[model samples]
Structures are given as structure tokens and as C-alpha cells.
Target: MTPTTAFKVLTGEQMAALEKDGSFAGAPVDLADGYIHLSTFEQLTETVDKHFAGHDDLHVVEVDLEALGDAVKWEESRGGQLFPHLYGPLTLDVVVAYGPLHRDGTGQVQRPITG
Candidate 1:
């Protein structure tokens, strides 16, 4: 089966549970020092799917923040195959920098505090 994509970011508590449960198929995973970094989508999906089960109505999307231009552009542009049409349009709200940012934070090398 084709590997699924990441719909949204996850919490540290959720990440820890996935790792302990072996839901990632023993792939390399890490959630250290208040940051999460994975090598591939397969690893990411394995963790995300465990918690995301039973939400079949929701479509999982993996968005590239850089390619989509700024937040305003994302809000205005039409979504692709990843996003569900019911969402109409998408809006990206970037949070403030807090503490030390990690290399893979929010698809960029910046810490995000999305509320």
C-alpha cells in the first residue's frame, strides 16, 4: 500500500505513546528535548495513524509551507488533492518563536506556537 501523508502536527504526549506502542513498525523515531524529527513519511504515518484512526471522514494532508507562498496565499489559493473540498479554502496561522527552534520545526527551522 502507498504510504499515507501527514495531515497535521502532533503533540509530544501523542508521539510518546506511538513510540512505546510500536505502532511505527520499529522505524527510527525521535521526540527529544521538546522536538520531533523523523526521516520519512512512512515513519510519520505509522505514528500519526495510530492516534488518527476512526476519523475516516477527515482527509489527511501534508502541506509544504514554503511552496504555498505566505499564509495569505494559502488562505486564498485553492487546495489540492491533499485537502478536502469541504474545507473550501485553507488558512495558515504561524505562531511566535519560543525557546530554541529545531531543524524540522513546522517544515522549517523555526519553532511554532500554534494555538
Candidate 2:
């Protein structure tokens, strides 16, 4: 994935719920924060390492920002970097692709196939 292709990390249950509901309002932390958190490809590994360390059945969802329109906002976050935050519900229509998250030999999450 490249920085141009934003992505969201989700738990299995969250993904399942999203699939069933047709739209994802927000995850637990996202609801608490009042916005959905999204990371660029460059930020993925660190985001997972910091927030999803022991998580199982994780999924990396590639999203089409254009489909989200103005609902997506880029704001300053960790390390003063601007991260994409969604102020509205995430519809399945914006999802380009998604699959289970795996780990590499170093115990870090493997990069998702973007092309």
C-alpha cells in the first residue's frame, strides 16, 4: 500500500459486523474518539505495534478516500504527523479490498497486498 491509499485496521468481529450492517459507524476506540482512525501505509506497522499488539484475527482494509468525499479529514496525530480521520460512517462501498492481517518472522504485521 502507498500513502495515497489509506487503510483501516479492524478486528475480526468488527469486520464481520461491518459486513453484516453494510456500514461501520465506528470501532470502540473510534467511538470514544468521536472519529474513525485510519493510517497511511507508512504508518501501518507502527500503528499495529502500538495499538494492536496481541490482537488476533485482525484485518487490514484498504479504503478509497474519494468515495468518502469530505467526510475524511487529515489531522495531526502521533509524532505530529497528519493522519486520516473519518468523521462519518464508513460504508462498504468505499472499501477497495480487505484481508486477514498476518505476521512476518520479526513478529511484525505483514504488509497487505495493495495492487
Best candidate, TM-score: 2
* Residue 35 shift from truth in candidate 2, angstroms: 0.6
- Per-residue lDDT tens digits of candidate 1, residues 1-115? 4222223333444434433552321112322212122212333344344544543332222333333233212112122222211111222221111222223534333223322
- Residue 102's lDDT within candidate 2 is 74
Compute each candidate's TM-score over C-alphas. Answer: 0.24, 0.88
- Which candidate leads in lDDT? 2
lDDT of 2 by residue, 73-94 (tens): 8999999989999999888888
lDDT of each: 0.29, 0.85
| Alpha-carbon runs more than 4 Å astray in model 2 | 104-115
Name every residue pair that clashes in candidate 2: none
